[model samples]
Structures are given as C-alpha cells and as structure tokens.
Target: MMAIFQPFFNIISETGRVVQFFFQMLDVWKRKSISRDLMFEQIWKVTVQSSATTALAGFFVGAIMTVQFTMEMKDFGALGYLGGLSTSGTIREVGPLLIAFMLAGKVGAFTSAELGTMRVTEQIDAIRCLGADPIQELVLPRFIAIVISSFFLLGLGLLLSIFGGMLLGKYFSGVNYEEYLRHIPTIVSLPSILSGLFKCFVFAVVLAVICTHRGYSTTGGAKGVGRSVVQTAVSTMVAIVIADWATSLLADIALKIFLRSR
Candidate 1:
C-alpha cells in the first residue's frame, strides 16, 4: 500500500512541476520574438489542418439538432421558432464544444507527439546546450498558434454550423431562408458571439499548455512519447469539457448580475 501511494505522490508532484513550467513560460513571454512564426504554424496545424474534421462535426451536430428540434417544434406548432432555436443553441453551446473536441483529437495529439518525440530523441537537449530556451523555441510558438487558431476555427465553425442548421430547418420545417436569416440576429446576439469567442480562446490556451507540458515532461523513449500523446489528448478533452461548463456558468451569473444592475 505504501509503494502504491508513493507512485501516486510522484505523479502528482510531476504534474505540479509541469503546471509551474507552463506558468513560468507565460510570465516572461520568453518566445515573444518568434511568436509570429509559431502563430503561423499553429494556425496551419490547429486551424487549417483540422478544418475538415471541425466542419464535419459541426455539420452533423447542426443537422441533428435541427432535425430533432424541428420535429418537436412541429408537434407543438412552433416550427416557426426553429431558426431562432437552432442559432441560439449552436452558437451558445454546440459550436465551441464541438470545435474544441475536434481540436483535441487533431491538434492536441499532434502537439504532444511532436514535442514528446523531440524530447525523447535528445533534440531538446541539443537546443538547451546551445543556450536556447526550449520553452521559448517550442512551447511558446505552439501556444500562441493554438490560441489564435482556436478563435478563428470556432468562429468559422459557428457560421458553418448555423448555416447547416438553417438549411435543414428551411427544408424540413418549411422555414423560409430570408426569414431564418433575419431571425438569426435575434437569437445570436453580440453577447453570444463574444461568449463563444471567449470560450474558444480559453480552450485553446488550456489545450496547448496541457499538451505541451505532457510532451516536455515525457521520459523513456518511444513508449513514453506514445503515452504522453495519448495522455495529452485525453487530458485536453476532459479539461475542455470542464472549462466549457465553468465558462457558461460564470457567464450566466455575470449576465444576470449586469441585467439586474441595468
């Protein structure tokens, strides 16, 4: 029992070290100078590379939501509300959640595997020997990239998902395109957009930091890298779900307080 507990304690300690490293890197912005290149790479990997997956997920989610909601609305003679319902639900919840999940599978795993490989192969050591900061050279670039890419991808995903929902609503629920478009403004307000963007940004940061930390802390060789990759992806997905719920809850509370003050 003591032996088992000892391993758990070590794991916890290592995890704490990883978290500290992430915060320390963020503090000095050590890689600020190379941020642009890293941003571009991250944009390409997290945003462009994951486009197809995000789009497919968004389309399916939108289509399914529209279908189910339309059926229910039709039964209740509220089919006219399909446009507003679809837009509100997708923008407020589904869009960010789905996109984050997709990115976790794609970008998150890739980041961990790449960094883990570098660590195991001694490339990271070589950089350190040259007096280069590994966090600045690797982690910082990927961090900025993911954050920027997440915002753009989430925005694109929202638009595409909303459009997909609208198409289904128009076809199956008999909603007119013009009317749906006009009603969308009512459901998806500025606040909703801001909320979605904010969630995306948070998700990006969390995903990048966790994945990079996992990679950097990896030991052993091939097996270790593989484990880190899987762990990073799994941890990122769990973190995103938790973060999403927390953000929504906080946003709701703030909105309520602001409205009362107004």
Candidate 2:
C-alpha cells in the first residue's frame, strides 16, 4: 500500500518544487546590476529576428482587411471611409495582436529553447558555481529586452500594416494616397495608440519572464529542454490573450472614469 502511494507522493513533491522555483524567480528583481549586453542580445534576437515575419503578416492582414472592407463599403456607398476604418482597426487592434502572437511563437520559443539548452548542458550550473546569479544574468536582461522589443515591433507592425492597406486601397479600391493619409490622423486616437503600446509592453515582459523561467527549471536533459520550449510558447500565448482582455477592460473603465470626471 505504501509503495503504491510513493509515486503519487513523489509527483506531489516535484510539483511543490516547481511552484517554489516560480516564486524564487519573482525575487529576481531584487538583484542589482543587470547585464546590459545580454539585454541587447535578447533585443536583437527577439525583435530584429522577428521583424520580417511580423512585417509580412502585417502586410497581408492590412491588404486583406482593405479588400474586405472596401467590398462592404462599396455595397453601402461608403468606400471613402475605407482608409480611416482600415487604419484605425489595424493600428488599434490587429497590428499589435498579430505581432505579439508572432513573437510568442518565434522569440518566446527561441528564448525558452536557448535557456533550456543551457540548463541541460550545465552552463547555467557553471554560472551558479561561479557565484553568479542566474536570475540577474539570464532573466532580467531578457525581460527588459523583450518589453522594449515588443513596443518597437508593435509600432513597426502598425506602420507596415497601414502602408499595405493604403497601397492596396489606392490600387484596388480606387482610393488615393493623399485621401488615405488625410483620414488616418482623424481616425487614430492617442488613447488607442497608447493602449496598444501598453499592451505590447506587458505582453513582452510576460513572455520573456515565463519562457525564461520555464527553461531555467528544465531538468531531464534533451527531453526536458524540448518540453520547456513547447510549454513556454503555449503558456506565453495563453497569457497574452488573458492579459489583452484584462488590459482592455481596465482601460475602458479608466477611460469612462476620466470622461465622467472631465
């Protein structure tokens, strides 16, 4: 009877260990002297490496939206509003969300796999043996990098998407470039842009921290590393969706309160 329960007990013990490891990671911020080089490396890898994919996706999304909306507008004789509608929708929602999703698959997975490999190869252990803090060296820099990178990527994605939409509108929908540009400013609100930026920043931080933590905790060599990579991507994406909703709700409430006060 005791033998049967031993495996279950061991499973519970492992689960407890993982939970403890997560809390320990939360304490990483207390350390001073973050690694600037590592942060830059992370930014380059997460942001620059991801740029092409995000840009391509943004272009297609913008082009398709323009086409679809133009068709609808044609039916309603409101084709002139296509530029403003497409720009507003893309910048405010589609652009940021798409870029974040791409980063979760690309940067998030890469970060997890890189750290997971280090863990399996005992590189992280070597750092620990040298009396260096893994959290400060490994996690903090990547966290900051991803947060900054996300903002830049989101902004770039917005620009590319808007460009794609404008070009498509001009060529296919008979809308001129100047007319498209003229309406964009009116449609793009400061609050909406700020909200998107804020969301991207939060998304990036969550991705980096969670993925790094997952990799840092890997144990069983190659298999563990692989598992960490998959888990990191999945978890980061789920977190992004949840965070987006929460941010939107909070922003809406705050806006309402501010308007009432005004």
Candidate 3:
C-alpha cells in the first residue's frame, strides 16, 4: 500500500526537482554565467563520443525496418513502395525513438557517470569553495552540450536512416533507387519532418536534465555514483518513451488539423 504510493510520490518529488533545476539553469543563462570554452568543449566531446554509436544504430534501424517492410510488401507484390514506406516510418517515428534509446544508453550513462564521479571526488565542492558556481561551471555546460549534441545526432541519425533504407532496398529487396525514392516526397510530408525534429529536441532536453540531475544529486561516494548511473538510464529511457508517445499523439492531431485546413 505505502510502497505503491511511495514510488508515485518519489516520482513527483523528483520531477519537481528537475523542473526547479531547469529553471535554475535558465536563470544562470540569463545572467550570462556561462563558460563559453567549457560549453563548446563539452559539446564537441559529447558529439564526437556519441556520433559513431548513433550512426550505427540509425543505419541498422533503417535497414531493419526496410527488411520488415520488404517481407510484408513482398507478399502483396508491393516491393516498389518499400523505400518510401520504410523511410517514412523510420523518419516519422522509429528512427527518433530508437536513436534516442541508443543515446540514452550511451550518452546518458556516460554523462551521469562522469558527473557522479566528479561529485564523489569533491571536485564540484572544490569549485564551489573557490567562489565559483558549480552549476554554471560544470552542470550548465554539460546540460547545454547534451541538448545540442543530442539534437544534432538525432537529426543525423534520421538522415542516415534514409540512405540505409535506400541501400537495403537496393541490395536486399531488388528495389532500385529510383523506385524506392519515388514516393517519398508524396508520402512523407512537411508535418512529418517537423514532428520528428520536434521529438528530437524534446528528447535531447529530457536526456540532459535526467542525466545531469541524477549525477548532480549523487551521494554516498562510489556506490552512489553507480546508483546514479543506473537511475539516470532508467529515468531517461522512461522519459524518452513518454515524450515519444505524447509527441506522436500531438503530431497526429496537428496533421489532421493541417489537412482539414488545406
């Protein structure tokens, strides 16, 4: 009884904390309490660290979706539509969600672990004792970097998914490039593209906040760092899935509205 409600209360408390932290970050940014060098360096580090995994995940996601569609469309003698359908589905939904999951495991875990380590080592405290704001110097840069890097990487993954589907279609499904790409412009609309990008941005923010919050709040030394990493992964993945579902619902509604207006 209490155990069940306890988790709910914990979730609510944690969410409030995350929101407060985000507002603190925004306030810091408004004050220009940011380190340009730290921010750029962190961005470059996260981007480089996550790019390879993102590419591999994105490409394989597109390829796998193509294969599934190929298997289905083949039964109906509809292989020619493989590219457009696969690419459309990947770009509009599968690509962003899967790629974000990958990012959560890779980028989210790493960031949380790194920050947790720093906290456990008293490095954050050392900075604070020196009359420096740790959030501005440490967390802010990471928060901004993760968001930017994630958004860029997610977009890149979506783009690569197109080529991946195209290649798989050619080699595996015997669908030529021309036929595979033919219906994309018609099937994949402006709203679909916008929805995917919007999801990416939302995912980026969620990942950054969850990771940083878990790490920044870590205690109890090394063990706590491990716990923080695990919690961060779970929280980020859950957040990403919820965001995906919400965005998908909103996208559908907006698409209907746009079509009706047209």
Candidate 4:
C-alpha cells in the first residue's frame, strides 16, 4: 500500500527541495556571476515563444463562450447583456484557467525535460564541482522568466478572450463593438480584475515549483527525463486546477466582505 502512494510522497519531498532552492538562490543575487543573460533567454523561450498559443486559445475560448451564452440568453430575449456575461466569465474563470493549462503543457514540460537531461548527464554536478551554485545559475533565471511571462500572458489572454467575444457579438449577434463592450465596466470591477491577476500569480508560483523540482530530481537517464516531463505536465495541470479553485474561493469571500461594507 505504501508503494501505491510513493509518488505522492516524492512530490511532497520535491516541493520542499524546490522551496529550499529558491531561498538559496535568493541569497546569491548580489553575486556577479548571476546571469541576467540567462533570464532574458528564458523570457524569450518561455514567454515569447508561447505567446502565439496563448493568444489563439484565448480568442477561440472567448468566441465559443460568447456564442454559447448569447444563444442561451436569446431564448429569453435578454441577449443584450451577452457582452457583460461573456467578458465576466472569460476574465473570472476561463482566461486564467485555460492559459495556465496551455503553459503547463508548453513551458512546464520544456523546463522539466531540459533540467532532467542536465541532471542525468551530470552537467549539473560538473557546475557544482567548479564551486558554482547550479540552482542560482540555472533555476533562478527560468523561475523568474516563468513567473513574469505568465503574468503578461494571462493578462493578454484575458484581453484576447474579451476581444473574441466582442467580434462574435459584432458579426453574428449584431452587437456592434460599442454595445458589445458597454457592460464591461459594470460587470468587471477593480476587485474582479485583481482577483483574476491574483489567480495567475499563484499559478505561476505553483508551475515553477513543480516543474523545477521534478526536473532537478530526475533519474534513470533518458527514460527518467521523459518521465519528469510527463510528471511536470500532469502535476502542473492538477496544481493549476486546485490553485484556480482556491483563489476563486478567496476572491468570492473578499468580494462579499467588500460588498457588505459598501
């Protein structure tokens, strides 16, 4: 029975190691050898390269949500509120959740595979032998890049998702640009926007921890690297869902408190 839960135990252990690695790297930031170059490279690799996928998915998700919601509202002759409804859904739930899922598959897997290979080849060990901190030189740059890029990606994705819904409303639902967007202010307030961004930041941290931990701990050479990649994807996706739910719950409670005060 312990064997059945072994992987879960390993995950917990990895999470701890990743946390420790983060703090150790944090202490080394004043060192000259800490490479800003690597961070930029990772930005290009993790964020810029993945932008197309995020935007495309956002557009389609928004359009589909608009279509579905508009159709349903039309049944009761209240379709005029379609823009507000769709945008609220996109920003509050679909946009953050969907973008995180896509990024987990793209960026998360790449991180794990790359780091896992380095571990298996003993390249990480070689760097350590030279009195270098591999986690600072290696993991920190990727970690920073992932978090910053995820922030930008999630925001852009929300915009694209709203744009997609607007387009659908304009061409198919006869909403026109102005009418389609008129309700945005009413439905999506400051707290609502902040909540979505909060979800994104939390997801970024979760993704970084899971991917790096799995990658750095990889075993068994080529096969282990492959396993780490799969584990990164699965664990990240699962974490994203859980983080999304938790953040959403918190947002709801906060919103309620604010409303009561007002």
Candidate 5:
C-alpha cells in the first residue's frame, strides 16, 4: 500500500538529503561555510552543558553493572575477575550506548525541535533567500559539533565508567584494594578506545542526519515540530543501535587487517 511505502520513500529521500549535505560540507570544508564563532559556540554548548548528564549517566551505568554482576560473579567465587570485566565492559559497550541514548534524548531532540521551529517560522527559507546554503549555515556546524562532542564524550564516559567501577569494587563488591586498582586501569587498550570513538562518530552522523532531516520535513506547524522531535529521538536511537553493531563488526575486520599489516 502507499501508506506502507510512504514512510520508506520519505526515509530514502531523507537519506539522499543527508548525502547531499555531507558532500556539500566536504566541498566547503576549506572555505568554512559558517563563521568560526557560531561553530565554536555550538561546540561549547554540546560539550560543556552536556557534561553533567554524561558524567552521571556514565558513572551510574558502570556502578550498576558492577553491582549487578559482582554479586553474580561472587556466587561463583570469581569476584577477583569482576573489576577488570566490569571496567572493560563499560568502556567497550556501555559508554558509547549510554552516550548515544543521552544524546538522542537530550541533544537530538533539541536539534530537531529547534530546526523544526525554524522551518515553521520560515527562518531556514529566509536564509536561503538571502543567498546562504542552509546546509552549510545550519547543518555543517551542527555536524562538526556533534561528531567532535561525541568523540570527547565517549572518552569522558569511558573514564567515568572506570572510575565508577573502581568505587564499586572497593565499596560494594568487597574486592581488595590491589585487585580493584588492577582490574580497572589494566584493560585499557588501543583497539577498544579506537572502536568506541569510531562508533561514536557514526552515531554522531546518524543523530545529525535524523534530526536535520526530520526538521526539514516539518510541515504542519507547532504540531509538526513536536512530531519531528519524537521522530528524531526514535529514528536516531534505532539508527544508532544498527550502526553500533555494524561498526563493531567493521572495527573487528579493520583491526585484523591492521594487525596483519603490522
């Protein structure tokens, strides 16, 4: 039915727009389509304002995983192994995932709603009429900000997660001091860090495309803007999960190739 296919076509059309926007950004990367001031301001907003939430989410995720699993591991008399396992698990999976969810709920929704409101207000069109590429003026800076922010946030989350696992191993898990310390900072590896950052970058791109596309598709008015926010959150999360698994496989392959090359 047309109704079933309508969403599919819209998604495809949006995909095209995202590609076009990406290419346009690439073309203008040197000239810097947008002003430095605007880009930095947006970057600051994404990175700094989001830090508290990121820290809390990352810490709690690590703590909860450690608490939940430490008990299970203890039943098997394997408590000694929990610290490293928990910390590594957090870095390899939890950090990027929670960060993606947080970004979807907070930043992605905000970007969609903001852009949708602008579209409703004809601001985007006005910018176009004034001889500015909306993609460059609006989308490029956001794309740059989010990708950079996600990478930094991924690292931050990893650190906080390790820190949280440390606290739990010491206080909640009944693990010994040397064991706890050794558990955490020990599993740090280049591949895990690189994979996490790479996934974060892909998520950043997914969020940007979903939010901006939904914003541009806004039609009805205030109602449309609200719809876009919801759509952006849902779409971004779905895209992130898919990308997460896919990138993990790609990372494995790439790591293998790198190892062979070396």
Candidate 6:
C-alpha cells in the first residue's frame, strides 16, 4: 500500500516544489531584480544555438506533413489542397509541438546541466555566501531568456514550415506554388494561428520551470546532474504533451463559443 502511494506522493511533492520555485522567480521579476545584461546574454546564446536546428526541424516537419497529405489526397484527386491541409495541420498542431520537443531536448537539457553543475560545484552556494541572491543572479535570467527565446524560435519554425510545405508540394505533387498556397487563408484562420502561438508560449514556460527546478534541486553530484537532465527531458516532454491536448480542447471550445456569438 505504501509503495503504491509513493509514486502519487512524489508527483504531488514535485508539483509543489516547481510551483514554489516559479513563484520565487515571479517575486524576483516583480521586484525588478533581474539583470538585463545577464538576461539578454542568455537569450542571445540560446537563440543563436537553437535557431538553425529549430528551423531545420520545422522545415522538415512541414515537408513530411505535405508528403503524407499528398499521398492521401492524390488517391482522391485532391492534391491541390495539399498545401492548405498540410499547412493547417502543421501550424495548428504538429509545428509547435514537435518544434517545442526539439527545443526541450536541446535548450532544456543544456540549461539543466549548466545549473546542475553550478549547484553541485557549490557555485550557487558561493553566491549566497557572498550575499548575492542566486535566484536573481542566476536562475531568473535563464528563466526569462528561455521563455523569450523559446517563443521566438517556435514562431520562426512555424513560419519556415509554410515555405517547406509549399516547396515540397510544388516538386512532389506537381502542385504549383500558387495553387499550393491558395487555400491556406481559407483553411488556417486567425484563431488557429493564435492558438498555436499560445501553445508555444505555454510550452516555453513549462520547459523553463522544469529545467530550472530540476537543476536547482540536483543533489548527487555528477550522477545527480545526469539524473536531473534526464528528469528535465522526460518531465518537459510529458508536460508539453498534456499542455498541447488541453490547449487544443480549450481552443476548440472557445472557437465554438465565438462562432455562436457572431
């Protein structure tokens, strides 16, 4: 009985810790204790590191989606709609989710390891001993940077995915660029675009919080840092998937309500 309940207790305890840490960061932000230079440096570093990879992943996602849609539509003589259908699917669901996963694996893991190292090496403790708040001097900048960079990178990926789908549609299905892009406006609405961006924002926050929390709590030295990285990856991925489902459901409901009102 105790063993079965242990996992549930662990989940609750972890959730509490994450929430507490998030509020601490929030309090720092509220007090304007964040260092602009540190925040900007982190933002630039992460953005530069992840840009190419994120763009490549986004482009391929669109291309693969186009290919799948093309195959399905070709059987029905509907290849002309490939661009719109694929673009709609990618932008609304696949693009943000998969791009976010890529960001988690790269950005999340690196941040966790870096923080974990500092924690185990007693750098964080040294800062505290010297009368500096590590949260303000360290974690806060990273937290803000990850949120900003992740948002921009995810959006960039979504943009590239459109071009990707168009290029692939033109070559693979013999669909002209104009025809391929023609139905996008008809299929992908403003609300859908907003929903995707919202999901990106939510995923970014989730990724930032998990990585920082895991890193800050790391205890066992090198092995502990490794464990934290693994935990960050697994937890962030699971959280993102849950967030994606919840956002999709809410977006659909909101759209329905809006349509009824109009």
Highest TM-score: give the candidate number: 6
* Candidate 4 residue pairs that clash: none
RMSD values, in order shown:
2.3, 4.3, 1.6, 2.3, 2.5, 1.4
Which residue pairs clash within candidate 5?
A: none
Instruction: Quote model 5's TM-score.
Output: 0.87
lDDT of each: 0.80, 0.80, 0.86, 0.85, 0.80, 0.88
Per-residue C-alpha lDDT of model 6 across residues 1-262, encoded as one tens digit per residue: 7999998899889989999999988987788667789999999998988999989988999889988898889999988788778887877888778767987999899999999999999999999999998889988888889888877887788778888888888888889989988998898888888888888788888889999999988999999999999999999999899989998999899889888998
| lDDT (tens digit, per residue) of candidate 1 on 29-107 | 8434665766687668677888887777777777788898887878788776677778778877888788778778888
Error of 1 at 42 (Å): 2.8
Predicted candidate 2 versus true structure: per-residue lDDT over 1-262, tens digit per residue: 8999997897577557545655666676664677778878878877888899888888888898899999888888877778788877886677767887888898788878888999999999999999999888887777778778888888778778878988999999998888777777787777777777777777776676777778888889899989998888777787788888888897788768777988
Off by over 4 Å in 1: 1-15, 30-32
Better of 2 and 5 by TM-score: 5
Candidate 4 residue runs with Cα over 4 Å from true position:
1-34
Which pairs in model 3 have colliding backbones? none
Task: Candidate 1: give the clashing pairs.
Answer: none
Superposition error at 13 for model 6 (Å): 1.1
TM-score of each: 0.91, 0.87, 0.94, 0.90, 0.87, 0.95
Q: What is the lDDT, from 0 to 100, of the residue 55 in candidate 2?
A: 86
Cα lDDT tens digits for candidate 5, 120-239 = 999999998999877778877877787788877887876787678778878998887578667555665677767767777788888877787787668899999999998888888888
Residue 49 lDDT, candidate 3, scale 0-100: 87
Clashes of 1: 0
TM-score of decoy 4: 0.90
